[model samples]
Target: MQSDICTIKVRDCSYIDIEANMAIVINNCFISTNVFRVSPSVASDEQPLLSYSHTHKKWLTGRYIGKLYFEYNGKPHCFEVQPRFGNANILILLEEIFNIKLAHNTSEYKLYDNSDNELLKKIISIIWVKTLSKINIHGLPKHKVEKLNKSSTVRGKIAIKRSVLPIYKEKYVVSKRIEKEVDSTIVAILKKAYIILCKDYSLTESMLSDAVKEVIRVPCYNKKVITTNQFQKIKYGAIYANYKEIVDFSWHIIQHKKQSSMHEMADTMGDALFLDMAEIWEKYLFTILKKCFAPRGWHVYSQQYRIYQNIGFERSIIPDIILEKDGHVVVLDAKYKRMTGHFSDYDRTDFFQLHTYGSYMESHNKKLIGLGLIYPLSERFDKEKLDKNFAKNLYGDSTSNTWFKVDGICLKDSHHQLTEQKDDFLRRVESLLLI
Candidate 1:
């Protein structure tokens, strides 16, 4: 049945049993694991409308941003607008990451909030700008060559040694390395990205069209393998600050059609809007903690490999953020979901995970690690600052649960100044450090 809210028809389906446990995040939208099923349109570009689900009521309890893609009734299912309560703060963070201030408090922001269209546009703008500005700064990409092509120029100097063999001069003499169009995989990937974005009719094609002439000259990529080393080279390169983000976003969209991963939108749909809300929150926290703690002779690390399941190192438990100091170790877990102090099953799981991390850190270093959970301090949660304690060491550690608490910290509060929030958080963190 068509939902009354929008032009597109909304359908309901039984949410797959396996996916029922995970809050799938895609395109910066979150779909709850508890939802039975949602209705999504395949050709979002053609309809330019979002799906409405009857079952979203069950799991859509709080303000969580990011779209979730699911297949039901042989069609895609999604929520049109995922509530982003901390939009103001998140926009500020993204702006900082992009190194540019966008019109957040303006009408464009309103349009994005209401329509969910310009949100992706803003994301792509970051990618396009960062990509074009740095793509050629290092000069056209180069590759080593040992064979001669039809138009190959032989390096007479190097070829002189092999000139004794006639074929060496004709076939292998032009062994000199050169920067050519065909060898530049980066350019090929960039060109493909431009074309892929252009194909997605929903997006403002002009955004990519503007970049076509600059990157279109590179030859198409004939190889399928996208190596880890290639991305690392671009990431560590001295180019745009957000170049890695741009490259990652570009590659995901380019590869989206190829790998749907159940949560992925159909490549035939052609539009790509994906953001891992969880990762974003973690990274944002890392920046804040790293900046504040760096001057104080503290070290902050992400995915600190502190635990492994087996001696062979086959399984691992790498927490998002870890703070190491002379006397104290703090494990900060960043959960993207909005909370009101009423811990849900998911929140409990997070608490246990943080507890496990603490346990591991303590056993490894012979020191009790301070645990902290940081949730978004939105207006909804701000009202219900109900004095709540979620876990008293849910990991069977009853003796120390009460005295040594796992502090639950909320950040990005609209009610308080950013500095004030940081001060409050730091205070809480200090108390944890004492124990």
Candidate 2:
């Protein structure tokens, strides 16, 4: 027996000792700690008996009395064993070590001491070969892997695969920065050109189109300066007065993706219409006061008192205008509606509201000169008779002494002719206050 040279798998001989001269070469071996173990121990007396005896006797004695503790991977175990070196004994030992019974389907092996070192060397050699074979150089230093190509490569070609690898990528970043600068410069030039053209030609569609094309040719400039729909919106004051025409013209240049629906436009148009009418009336009123009352030293602040009551409930009331001069407070509420034959609940409510303001001022001992509800001309009541009736209704006939007097003033003319009536109303209010 040439030292009974035999190789065993690394798993088979997890624990083994070999002589230094007897070489063990492990190849491709994954060396890791075994999760299972077998503890072989003998009684003190049995140990002495085996130590003192001859080789065969020691073997026999050890086999007879030595205890083997089998601990499977991930499990705790203890057992007594008759330690023998036969194949059946080895199978039994392995079965106990792994907690699996030996069957005809399973293969088995035994490792003598001489073969242990050679098996280890074989394992180490195999591991070294595998590790070296798996050495990847693609992500390593320049000496390891070839440098990627920088020349612009077509799709599906493996050039510089990473963004950071190509020189053109840096060039692309630089080009983008240059393009942005150029675009900004172009836009500034275009804006200045547009302003110059607008100043010359008054921003008509043809002129605007020619101006834009002079800088950069654009399609659809010849169609219309202002769209038919946009013209209607501007004429009707559907948008703000200042920006309406300009915004409409801009819309023609850059068409909106979604135009406002008829319903949305109508709602917006209603507000615009009211504001337009309100502006007209506001101008008329200002003119009337300036012409009629300015000479009298009575400064009329239109839309003046926005009353906010802080003590009781949070209440807000805004009188149309407050005509004040020389310590007289003339509270005027403008009613667009005409006075009816029998006063409607709304009319009475307006009266009560004004009366409350009057009462509040009187109770506070403040100088509430007089309160007046001004309405448009009505067929139900004569203007002079209505004024007297309004005064009698507010202050009872010789029965009640209200601190502030409430009266109605009817203007027969349109807002443009309100100057004449405003003067008369101011004089009446002045007389009532004895000023």
Candidate 3:
């Protein structure tokens, strides 16, 4: 017996067509119009329609002509379907279909622009075909497929959990520790810069009144009582300018000549001398150190500052300067050398000497945290290895004095540039003092 004919219903209509054309089957009932050609249009110059018999798939209708509009799922999508020679028509069939308007000058005249269709297809494919199966199944039989699915689910959950948890807490802790160390180092360097300035300028506490007045005026001070520019003027007029005068006077005494008037020579000498005196370390570094550290409550001391000690060693190894703030000490020794290679056994010995200062502080109940070795700008030293060696030589272990450290700072051409302006010097000093 022949199989019972099955009828397919669309919308409110039923259709039965044995015709080979799928379009005829679709349109004969749903569309209710026999005269209309419901199949997609093609052009005379287009290729013949190719078909797969087994899969019942229709091939391109000739080379498509004009634009083709169709509905897929619930949305209207368009493709540019054009023959080698013809006007394009947009096809729109679905209810609530979206319209697309293309410019006449579009380059692809043969193919209907299906970019939007492709984009929708990709999104739908990913959602339905790719990701849908990944949804969690709360309960399942203990079959292999179920077990494998559960394992995948657990792995994804663990990954999400790790992503949200505390992997970097230790890194943050280390960073904070390093920052504190840097701050402490800066405080020490600034203290030393201040001492250098005071000694070089022969500045007493009373002498510092004018400098203080100028210092308070700086913008960083943030006080209406003084401006940085005004304070700089006072400091320049008092300390740095006077040093310039002394240098000029000394130069004039050395270069006496009959042709040039001594007064004229003195005037020329004064400019040169000022330039020369400004190049001095004590003048520039101290000013910079003061400006850099004073705002942070760091005190710099140079030269005459004394740290008396008896660490079973008879003689005191007085450092060039000591930077101190809130009871923390940073011993800084300045070296005037051309090449950084001059770190001799003597220099190493001197470092050991400074380590003695640290030992003294530890023994005598003082809060000595670190030591700094300051050199001219061109000099470079390996601070890590130096610190390691220092700890080993002095404390008998590479890490014994973990808190006690050594660092190097370079004061290059900043002295010459900074000495001319008190404020500039202070700014540079502040930067140099940074640990």
- Candidate 1 lDDT, tens digit per residue, 8-82? 212111121223322332213332321211111000111111222344433232222333334444554544333
**Residue runs of model 2 more than 4 Å from their true location after superposition:** 1-287, 302-312, 340-342, 363-365, 378-384, 390-394, 397-430
lDDT of 3 by residue, 110-159 (tens): 23323222321222122221111221121111111111112212321233
Model 2 alpha-carbon miss at residue 370, Å: 1.3
lDDT of 2 by residue, 169-240 (tens): 453211111111112222332343344334321233332222234333422223333344543433312222
In TM-score terms, candidate 2 sits at: 0.32
Best by TM-score: 1
Query: Model 3: residues >4 Å from true position, as ranges?
Result: 1-279, 303-318, 338-346, 379-399, 402-435
How well does model 1 score by local distance difference test? 0.48
lDDT, model 1, position 229: 70
What TM-score would each prediction reach against the true structure?
Answer: 0.62, 0.32, 0.28
In candidate 3 the C-alpha lDDT for residue 208 amounts to: 30
Q: What is candidate 3's TM-score against the reference?
A: 0.28
